[model samples]
Target: MKTFLLNSALLALTLSLSAVGGPTASPALAAEPTPAAPVAVPTVDVDPALWVVKDADTTIYLFGTVHILKPGMGWFDEAVKTAFDKSDRLVLEMVEPGAGEAQQLFAKYGLDQNGKTLSSKMTEDEKALFTKAMEKVGLPAAAFEPFDPWAAAVTMQVMGLQKGGYDVSSGVETQLTAAAKATKKPILGVETMESQLAIFDTLSQETQVKFLVEASKVVDDMNSSMDAMVALWAKPDPDGLARVMNEGLTDPKLYSALLTNRNANWAAWINEQMKKPGTTFMAVGAGHLSGTTSVPKLLTAYGIDAERVAY
Candidate 1:
């Protein structure tokens, strides 16, 4: 479940709660924002890739995104800015939430209102480790009792990223959102918060418990996991991103639900959108734009051509 949540395209940003740090449009608990370390690399050296799918009347730009990044990554270059300037609409995985929606999501799905607590699924040592991890992140153990294993897993990952100095405020989605708002372009969501959360919400109890146990065991390693992923992301290597995204995603059904199925759906949406007569700027997690089930590849299966745009 940790792999599923951490590699979850753009779902991480959408579901983050307050405990994980900052108000997310998605679900998470709360924590105060800590200062981030200075970016080790200059932005001028980074040139993230982009792609475009167009017909005579309509065009769609697909830009993959990282939901948490160190500041001054220099990813917003002229090519990206030019695409955004010509786009008539902006599309994301889902609409980022307003002030109180993340809290509502927590109450709705993350709470233990039914009396099932996270501790119930852990062994003695696991419980101790979980407690220690919670304290390490400055969250009280009881504060996470209400969370289901999947939610707890996501929270742990988010906390790990925060601790490692990744900043959601500097993420691509946040910047593009601000830009779209500033330019008065209409914003569209391909899926709803409920639909996205339902992916984990619908997992079997056995799987959920397994996820919790595995997450507890590796709570301290989340930084290294994210660091590896960020390294691949910084390279802008689609094949490497696909490989990293697929790491530990061994369960076929789980992979389908998390990546394959969703990618197919998004590809279909892009296909349908192509029949319309306007340009759209679409940004999703980089993972979704890579791999065999990527939006571009899946679109090819349906006979649409999506060409990679050079930096």
Candidate 2:
């Protein structure tokens, strides 16, 4: 049963990454000729996906973002650049975690100095697995000693992705933020950093332990899962991605808290943004755009139209 739980964790985490998002509808938009390159970069032909919500004056491009990717994957093509270039502002789930922002936040919520250490909370077999997993990713055992289970889970998720060849520099969020900065456009966050972090921080300890245990199991098999994610995203298969993510998570409460609730909140925000007049580009995790509880669906429920752009 212990080994079974350990193995099940990887599949759940994989699903979690691909677990947010809604369906697609379309009107064709003409693609202008792509401009000359600023510098020579390796190119890969993959079209992820994008959606647009517009009224008379306001046009917001909704994009799904993979937080990490292997270096040299060329996803910033003409269609994406066109939408991004036309937008006046860039919106993300949270502001960029630069200048020790993450560390400061972790110090406040992640530390469990008065409570049991992470190892003490784990079973003997689980502790061994956790230590081995950390070491495999070059994280010292002591590094996670003070962390809450949720924090440890999140940390391990990143480490697993990194070990699988996904580079943070190549992630959609990083690229878009850099472009927004270089172009001097304002960057807005849909939610505060604190609110985003609090999603996990506020979870019950049993749930947090479940999350952490599952995360520990993914170290060896994350690559295959990531590959499936990239393929689904590259195909821009919102419906397929939704099915993979929404069905994989067995716990309704966790799914609701992590993906469903957030999508509804974002949909509500989008409805408000539509009332104002401006072209804003909003990029969030792809999973939030699919399934029945996705942002697009929620927006549709509110009688707002979110059209997928045909590339």
Candidate 3:
């Protein structure tokens, strides 16, 4: 079977990068415990997208987010703010753990203690590609010696972007989370940290390495690809965003794990959230809201009346 680039998909689709810090770890994903350095507030404003699902008593606002961005986007205002301000609670893909806890969790599943190296799973050709990628991100070959392929893939993909100046602190969810905390509004997550890790861990080793190789191939294009995706997102063009993000999603289990099944679960969760009387602001990665397997598309099957909120 052919492999697709799932590393970018993991960043684009799941927004699952956690605190995997070390001198060698990707800066954007490393150091989750540390408070983010203050961002240079951008004067250039942008209108990303959002949707509204409602009935007489319950209203849920669904927004798509980019998990990392270059440090100059002014996104958390206009319609996005109105919806969030009116919301009773904020729902995210997952609530991240703090400090050593997130690092411990990532290492627990992503590392090999018995000294099985990540490159040992690859062919000579694949190893050559992976080695070059590690070097491109300014990490040594031995830095990933203990990495599982998925972990290496995660590190390489995000590190490539971070090296290009994308900061996790500048991501959509990061700022929203900070604001939500300041206001003391309740925040909830659709998945747990352990469960998100298991999605990658349970993949067949072959699949994991396949994606790792995919990461190696695309690491050079990371900035350009993300620039295009973010451009589409700023236009609030879900179709264009879908076209870019969902491209090369050929691996069946990866497609299911990263988008389809998770989206279905989210739709089901949104449907259930409608049972009680309250407003919810549901924010997830743009990939989850823009595709055919998007939460809005699935919500339609459940007879949940979801409409584009014209801002």
Candidate 4:
């Protein structure tokens, strides 16, 4: 159970990363014109209505997917596949083939000062806590010395999940991308790799430390985290999402910056695509489709209605 929870915490982080949109753009860009405020998009009050969206000619199955999965977990339910089969194109946060570039972007945002390893930057107590956390997950303290705290946390979580049997190779996006490729379906991305990485780069140093501390706590109760995530994904209850947002998300400002702001941006992009001709089956993290601040709710603000489809 401990192993399962640890894997789930890792998986949850993966889902959040994939869905939240990576780091923000670099600070060197020219200032653009400010856009008008978004109108309040009316949300359809419904349960289990988070993932699917439809219209007359096109249907986008908004799957909230786990990026790592235990064998035979059955994340790809029949309804999800049926939606994929009916579409002309498949869209992901970032396609796997382009993942290398994404990693490069991530490296750029990470701390790179000489003689300033993440471990060295930590206070004595934080260093001790981080060391214990890593040991609990079967990792060496020095293994994370070269990276920033946020980057190190992400790495430790992914490595722990891999050790606990949640294989990324068996993830929903992996299978879906394969199927899309086999069928010659057009694949697309909601945002650029640089744009996603930029979000992390924009975080203040203090915020990064807070993220690391919260992540350490999460590692301690891996199974409960996994069970909570599984229950949420199995049925995207708004209340469940709210609870996770309230409880699981330790940094309120970071959560808003990472999740809510990006959801609005993605929602704006998705709305534009809806105006175009072809049918697209969009698969993003399930978390992006839930809660009051979700993509679907944002779409409502744009006057594009997204209805939930039955499985």
User: What's the C-alpha lDDT at position 43 in model 3?
Assistant: 57
Q: Which ten residues in a row have the lowest lDDT in candidate 3?
A: 1-10
Model 1 lDDT, full chain set: 0.72
lDDT of 4 by residue, 120-216 (tens): 6778888888888777766667645655666666655665555555566566677888899999998887755555555665777687777777677
> What is the TM-score of each predicted model, taking all chains together?
0.87, 0.83, 0.88, 0.79
lDDT (Cα atoms) of all candidates against the true structure: 0.72, 0.68, 0.76, 0.61
Output the lDDT of residue 101, model 4. Answer: 50
Please identify model 4 stretches exceeding 4 Å from their true place: 1-50, 97-103, 236-238
What is the C-alpha lDDT profile of model 1 across 1-311, one tens digit per residue? 34325533224433354535543322224444445455565454466768999989999999988877766777777788899999999998888665366556655665455778778877788788778877766566766666777777677766667777777777788899889999899999898666777787778767766766667676677667766766677677888878876875666767887788999999989988888899999998888888888889999977898888877
lDDT of 4 at 191: 59
Q: Which ten residues in a row have the lowest lDDT in candidate 1?
A: 22-31
Between prediction 2 and prediction 3, which has the larger lDDT?
3
The regions of model 3 sitting more than 4 angstroms off are 1-42
The candidates, ranked best first by TM-score, are 3, 1, 2, 4
For candidate 3, lDDT tens digit of each residue in 141-237?
6667777888778767665676677777688878888999999999898987767777888898888888788878877787788788888888879
Compare the candidates by lDDT and give the number of the best one. 3
Cα lDDT over the full model 3: 0.76
Model 2, span 24-128: residue lDDT tens = 100000111222333446777888888998888999999987777777777788688899999999998877543244445545666674767888888888888
